[model samples]
Target: MAATNQGGPSLLTRTTLIVVAVILVVFAFHALYVYTSERSEIIDDIELDVAESLKRLSKSLGPFIESYAVNEYESLVTTEAALKRHFAVIVEDFEMGEILGQPYYLFGQLRQGDGQYVDVQARDTSITEQLDQAFYAGSAPIIGSSGKVLGEVWVYASDDILVKKLDRALLEELFTVLVLAGILSLLLTAVLRRYFFNSILGIDAALKNSDQEGIPKAPVPSFRYRELAVLSNGINTMLDSIKGSRENLKIERRRLRNTIIGTRSGIWEWNVQTGETVFNERWAEILGYSLEELAPISIETWMTLAHPEDLQRSSELLDKHFRGELDYYECEARMRHKNGHWVWILDRGSVQSWDEHGRPLVMYGTHQDITERKQAEASLSMAAGVFRHAREGIVLTSAGGTILDVNSAFCTLTGYARSEAVNQNYEFMLASDHHNRDFRKQVLSSLENEGVWSGECWIPCRNGSVFPTLMTIAAVSNNDNEIEHYVTLFADISHLKQNEEQLRQIAHYDALTGLPNRLLLSERLRHAVSTTRRHGDVLAVVFMDLDGFKAINDTYGHASGDELLIVLARRMQTTLRECDTVARLGGDEFVVLLPELSSGTDCKPILTRLLAALSAPVDLAGHSVHVSASLGVTLYPQAQDIDADILLRQADIAMYQAKQRGKNQVRFFNGMDGSAFNSRLVPPASSDQSEKQLD
Candidate 1:
């Protein structure tokens, strides 16, 4: 009963106060209405009086104004006692000198002491200014006999009169409102005490005896008034609802607990003010521990287990959540596990309740173990790094052979940007002149049969140039053994190809003159023999030795001798037909093969040209040097079937005979019989040439 009484004032006192407030409001509105109406009426009456006086004055003064009777107009306007009594009057004269750029008016005032009209000194004031100074004003026009308005007659009363009238009316209204409000409050207090006082106290008592959760212990009894009775029934219904809601809340809490357990997430509750904390069993399990092992838990326990680098960030996020700068706190941080290794945790929470001062009081959150996810992310990052920075150009293509992606090395090697390369066909990088449809089909077949294909290829670039690359293309398959994509790895092998070409050049050609060496000449000679036999054509093998090459080498240095050999070799090569071959057998010794000839005589003209070419002067070390050749010619299909070596020996024997006969001459091996060879000298194509014979 004391608690109910201590809550606030009794029902009677509160009702009286409410009634008094309502009465005061009503009186205020009524006073406002009365004040507005009375002021309007007073202003209207003053205006009417001023208008009537102005009209009478204008009528009396119009005649004087029309007749130009200035004195009479001034006299009539000034002596008008009725107009001057409550208003200031003026008579405007059209013929008067201007004041303030307007017609000056004669001013008149009524003296309050004697109630007489008196003229004041004329002042240069505008008529609009005079009207603004008055509370109420009216005007009429003064006309001449010709019906033209000469001037205006304005009458105005002072603001003092309107102010005095409003004051007296407001005082009377306020007094009446006060008296009515006092009587209404007293009557309201008595009525409320009799009808509602006891019923309100009973309701308060019932509410005070409610359970801890605020469900009422008993329903409010019925009241005498219909409104109070309805309120009582509503209170009883609310209590019944509270009981049902409490039971449902218990069931929902159980279900939520079960759901949390099923998800395997850790649950935590914290009292932010007291530094107290509560953790579920799963919270400890996430860190590889039982709840018993983490006894006496508090907020400090979490801080101790958290990685030192993460504590500062966690504190900052917690502060932001407490200050309402964030809707909730979420952080991914590492914590020390029971096994002495760091474990990644996803910590999320929100402030569930606040103190009266709006500070954080209680918080709830969950923790999820994310160590495995973090490890996977690290692995993916490492793989991406390798793909981006590897030395080899790597290409990823879809199963349909469209380029999906390429690394930086690919761009560097192919001279195509990543944007230009993606979505293009895989063949865009291949040299079109080097590779054809058959080549692509071969590559595809290889991949289908062996899952990989690797070889040297020419790759074209954006600048219209191509390079050699060692390319390896392999089919990438998924777990279902279906080919999904093709991964191509290639390295620029232009330098390696260059090295191989250099090695080949060193092996096949003469070091001094760049002519075919003995090894190459032998190979070509064998091939030529076979071709001539197949076509049944005549072939000539010529052995030539320089007549005076050793004397030139002795006279000039070996360098000069080499220079002469190079120049002479090039001249001999140009002098012969494209079907013939000229090779450097050794120092100052050369061999020439003439194939596809109709007869042995077809080569005589060629041999003469060779002699003339070798005899030409050569510039060596600033001196002109002349050299000639002793030539020995042998034709294939001799009397007895002869091999390439026998043909060479016969030509050599003929060359010895030519040199013995004379230095510059051509000798032909005529025939071979068992072990002996016959030699016959052949004349040059010109008439000045000589011939010789030997057996």
Candidate 2:
């Protein structure tokens, strides 16, 4: 094949020729220049030699002419002859001429007796070539000894000497250049031919040995020439690409087969024009039927199996796919299985070929069984509903503590909007500023180790008010068992805590007065009695009744009575020492337990102070109510051991005695006066008498 018509002529040959031609041309020009220069130099040297010879000739003739000025004509002629002979030896093609006015002559041939100057122009034609080869010619005037102008002498030399020397040198140099250029060209051509021939041979062998598929089985042979090596590499790369494409095609075929077999997908092809359809074995298997049983099917088969409601949507999607409105046809639809059960299917397809008029001729697609997926989606939807409506606050966070999701309850509890909470770190919500780096690290460590943590923590709301919550943090793990997120559930227990506190208060204290009631008072009194016995000191139990409390209640209403009782309770508490205990037994009655008392005298001052405090006028409902407290004082460690109840009863009896003995006075209970202070319930009449005395 005409050298396979590679891109151009062989590069090696072209480059070698170009290089050799450039060298030869350059050398030829140099040789010519050197020849011309040598010739010129030879001519110059000849001219210089001629001029020097003329100078010597003139100097020699100068002496002759000077001597001849006084000599005879014969003597002068003889001197001239001698001078001519001297000049002849120094110059080539030597000639000596004498100038007389405009006429000139040689030394030996003067035309006339005075001066028949030899005319150089009158030379024989036979010697004209010789004369034309003249190197240099010049004339100089001879001066006599007295400085008189003598006849001029002309000298000339020919170029024959210069020509002879130039021919010899130039011939030698020309031979050298021709020989050198020949050898170098031959060497370059040989080297280039070897490299080009070998590279081309290797390439041809590679191409010839290539596979029938036009893909090389082996790499192209390497080359010393960089461009040729690049060509080889390019061919090898193209071959590799072709091989890779074939492998990829095979892999794709296998993958398509595996996809049809492995997944719950059934492949199908439909010829739109022919109204015929083809199904793979998997297609029939998905619907609980054998391929043989479903053979010889048409488009009507699908129409019959597809649910009526889904048929319209699937048809619409198919029409859109045909119109190129979508890249593919995809829909979830229900189709009746062979067992008469409706199976949800995910159908997807694309146009495989088109007709000349841009209508779909053939389409291919798959039907994927999605019944399980649908059920799972329903379950997930239920779970989502629970997450949304659960009462407890729920937060989902990344492992890095960035909040990813929050329920409405969380938004309500923390007083943060959903938009504000998402993507925010939970650190800012911790109530305590002192929960520093170490504390946070411990929390993370606990989560990583235990996967769950539960504790009470204070969380601040967006309003900057903090509430206590029972918080539970659980780590949610991914399929790899790595902690991917955190699920935190917390409930605000502040109201629960408040209820517990209220119950405690109601159990131990009087609601209206906020003072310890009878139960708490008795408890304190027992402890006080024990302390008095241990320390060898007296413990006073003083019981007091407001004198006219009932009348005040009757006149101003019950609320005013409660207000008076609250005022008296506060006054009674403030009148005692820090160690003292004051309590309310019932309506209009208060008890004081003073431990560490030295004697009954110690009780007198406290009882007096109590009466004064009660007598202070109390403002009630815009009315000032004057009331007095009648105190009955009882001492612990008196006569015999006594319990807290008996101590209180003795105080009550003493209080009645004080009331009967002109009310608003303190009475002490001792064995000597225990009979006079009888413990009996006060009658209504006597209580009225006491109230009148207070008024």
Candidate 3:
């Protein structure tokens, strides 16, 4: 019974509030409508009142005023009387003198009551609301007949009786407003209690009592009573579940971001329709930009970072990918790395996500640094090629002397094909077998200790013929200096041996007479002089110079002179036996190397044969030219002990002494035997030579 009674009051309060609000609203609307109608009527009434007053005033003064004004009023009294009559309607509020003192007559007026005039001096008073306004409160014009408007008529009036009644009716709405305010408050409280407040209370209760997971979900609403509450609770539960799911999704996304960025892998997403792209921070950085540098990415950003050489390739690949022809987008190309250097990367990518139409929406990829590995492989390939194709015989051996690698040059050098030489030991191929046993042990031991052995050795070829070779062997090592292999650069030196002998012959032997030159002569002289000094046997060095050879050269050319010199060198070489050495000093000069002379007189036969040999007429270049040589004989042992140069100098002086004696001659030096003999130099002059020249 008590609950029922309480419910009744609550219901009654709610019903009363609604009823009061409707009644207040009805009254307010009615008041506003009535006020609006009354205001318009008041305005119309003021206008009509002003018009009526003006009509009455005009009627009162129109006839006389118009008649006098039309006559132009020559008389003051006539004009004054007419003006006085016109001002009568507006003269009531002013004194008679003041009214008559106004500037001009009044014909237009709205107030016709009690001789109230208007417009007495051309003052505009066309509108008058004060006379008939319901709420009029303003000043009005007070015209007098004094020809001067003395004052303004101030009127304070209330709205007409009907308007006052309307205003009074509006004022009377206070009791209804109070009733409406209380009722609205009650209604608002009831609605809040039923919907918002009750729902909020339920939520609070659930929050307090529910488990940590969330508020326990309530059952679905079926009835009207608290249906909104049930629905709100259901929405809250759904929102909690959604929030949890969203948070889990956020964590997963963060984990994915960490994986990609930690690996320095770039991720991208593209919208086909809009041609918009999104790339992660590291991905942008890989292209030499920060996340902020390129965002809301477009084709322009990709194009800017892409290598110019790869532009067309990337475009074609993209076109093909969009056509569903390729499943993967993988490429190993150099993308410009950060700081504008090209980096070799393995750019492997896959279509991570796609739209319903099979269009690529997102791509995930990775870049791997493989530049070192690539370079090492290329280096190895080049090394192999050079070793196999080199012109020099390059052989690679194991540290144990097993030949592991050999080039074409090696095959050609040994006259053995590559296959025949492969597994052979390097020591077995050497032809210097007499020294091999000891040499091998030393070389192998040295190579083991020092990692290198390089020297000259004899090696046998394919035909079993032996040849000398210059070989350089070096051990290629790692960082630790452990021998990885041995490289032997060797070449056959057979041609070099023959060349060496030829060079020796050219250096020591004269080409003209096939006799020893000054070099061989000096060498033999040293030995001969050493022997004579030890054995007490005397040695002689005879130096000879050709006399009158210039006459032969001038008569015939250098050819005849060379032939004569050749003959002279040969005869001197023949004059001395094998024990003696004869060599050309140069030109027409010669030196003899004599050893084991019995006496100083033994040089006498050598000198006689040399002179007899030069006496023969020599045929040179088909031209016979008479040539003779001046001989200087110097005995060694007798001339104390002088070196080769001083000995040759003595021989040269003795020869000059001989030339001073006459034409062709020989001179020998004596031990202080200054047999002063002047070389009666006969000049090719004196008119006597002119007769001999003619003869």
Pick by TM-score: which candidate is best? 1
* Whole-model alpha-carbon lDDT for candidate 1: 0.81
Residue-wise lDDT of candidate 3 within 275-320, one digit each (tens)?
Answer: 6777777676666678786765785776776678776776677677
Q: Which runs of model 3 end up more than 4 angstroms from their true locations?
A: 1-384, 396-406, 411-449, 454-470, 475-486, 491-538, 570-581, 596-617, 657-667, 674-695
Please list all clashing residue pairs in model 1, or write none if there are none: none
Better of 1 and 3 by TM-score: 1
Stretches of candidate 1 exceeding 4 Å from the true structure: 1-381, 428-439, 462-466, 672-695
Error of 2 at 200 (Å): 81
State which candidate, 1 or 2, has the greater lDDT.
1
Model 3, 592: alpha-carbon shift in Å?
2.2
Which regions of candidate 2 deviate over 4 angstroms? 1-390, 397-408, 416-471, 480-482, 493-506, 523-540, 551-560, 573-581, 594-609, 619-623, 634-642, 668-695
Ranking by lDDT: 1, 2, 3
C-alpha local distance difference test of each model: 0.81, 0.74, 0.63
Error of 1 at 196 (Å): 99
Candidates arranged by TM-score, highest first: 1, 2, 3
Clash count per candidate: 0, 6, 25
**Clash total of candidate 2:** 6
Best by lDDT, which number? Answer: 1
lDDT of 2 by residue, 124-214 (tens): 4434454344456666665556675555655555555677888887898789888988998988788867867677777877786656555
RMSD of 2: 52.4
